[model samples]
Target: MSNRSRPDSAGSPRGSDEAAQGPGVSAGTAPVGTVLVVLHQARSTPGRIGARLQRRGYGLDVRRPALGEDLPQTLDGHCGVVVFGGPMSANDPHPFLREETVLLERALARSVPTLGVCLGAQLMARALGARVDGHREGVCEIGYYPLEATPAGAALLPWPDHVYHWHSEGFDLPEGAELLATGRTFPHQAFRYGMNGYGLQFHPEVTREMMAAWTERGAHRLTHPGAQPAEAHFSGFDRHDGAVCRWLDAFLDAWLAAAPLK
Candidate 1:
């Protein structure tokens, strides 16, 4: 990552002026804009999603409020915001978690391009006045699982043959939100709130490295009650890699083009 690309939270609440330039200043040159990537843990880097955005000329300021860094008060200079998953639940009493939800509220209300992955999706749901809690009893999906897109989902998004899942908690559909996809174990797999805000319950941003790190650390959770082994999550990566990457690229390109950060 370039020094200007990955801004940390140590110095200031807001990033440097250079890091605040919004996206698409040039067609094929270096990325001129910045995207705020809210990371919950060190291991959960933006991975392939971040890489794609960078290739499209978007710099990333990856922040971790969990480490006592303050989140920016506004999205004035960011083209988009993406919150990655974590082991922590959105319902936790931690102040940082609450702040994350508040940030999501601001992002959605302002119509900034917003994406939430897994636990981040739960936070987005909470921000939108939805219930976020544990999955139904006897259902804990932890590996690659099938996602059935709704009619609306089929129309709006590409259908990945299967998406990777690791969450034990699921979200309820927020008021006025459209359910884009569903799973057998967890009904709410993906949703869209308003024009620019999206919440995905699966890890579309996962790369081989991120998956290895997660499985290595979360090995216990894989075989715990109602879960599959770690290998199940990765074995089909070879088969699913092409479709998944294409889907993410197309989805993100369309998403950014629809309503870029103002």
Candidate 2:
């Protein structure tokens, strides 16, 4: 399944699945399970997503295509696929990125659960045949921004009034997909394909440490430097973690329940 892969309930000891099942673990409960994680950038971390899934008992098989690592096996038997944020453009001279999206298309085809954040959302849109480009805003959106959930978005994600934004690129809603959220500059803040897939242009996976790391690494892009200076912004987060992860966890729980085990 991967260069390094294993599984147990996320809350249990790594090797306790088989021993505790008493040989009655059905076909659905494979001892070695995983959730394929596509790391789109150097800094993207799986904050609440990992925490939530760990509570529900699932492990991750991280795939860092940007770092030259090959993608793990398909989403079958895996809990789901989570694509993280990054600075690279999905359309910027890269095959691995496109390849990961193609794999996402396969996930969609099979109704496998997937959650894409920031650049991950754009790539997921592209994979679903949407038109994505950066020329719309022409400026980097580097902090917390507002989001308006559509009727569908409301039903699906129940997102708060505002969410964070960290990318310059945006996408046109793809065919057969529903737009979930929008902002002043980007109409495609979030999207969904069926019940099992989600695309979020904001960094819902970002925690305090992750945000601090991102700010530090991207400090070069910031001109001003001071306490609460005109640039650094994390004050608007508003603890929307419940709305964000609730919908995502629902997707993971439903799709993975039906996941095919090899």
Index of the highest-TM-score prediction: 1
TM-score of 2: 0.76
lDDT tens readout by residue for model 1, 1-262 = 1111111221211222112222333655655578899976544467667767776777788899987878998888787999977767788888998999999999999888899988788899999999987755745777688888899988986788688777778899999999999998889988988888899988777666556656666676666556767677678666786788888888887788778643
RMSD of every candidate to native, in Å, equals 7.0, 8.3
Candidate 1: where are CA atoms >4 Å away?
A: 1-30
TM-score of candidate 1 against the unseen true structure: 0.86
Across 50-160, the per-residue lDDT of candidate 2 in tens digits comes to: 555555556666777877888865565575788876666777668887788888888888877787877777788889888777644355566666778889766643566
Angstrom error at residue 35, model 2: 0.9
lDDT of 2: 0.62
Clash total of candidate 2: 1
lDDT values, one for every candidate = 0.74, 0.62
Provide the global lDDT of candidate 1 against the true structure: 0.74
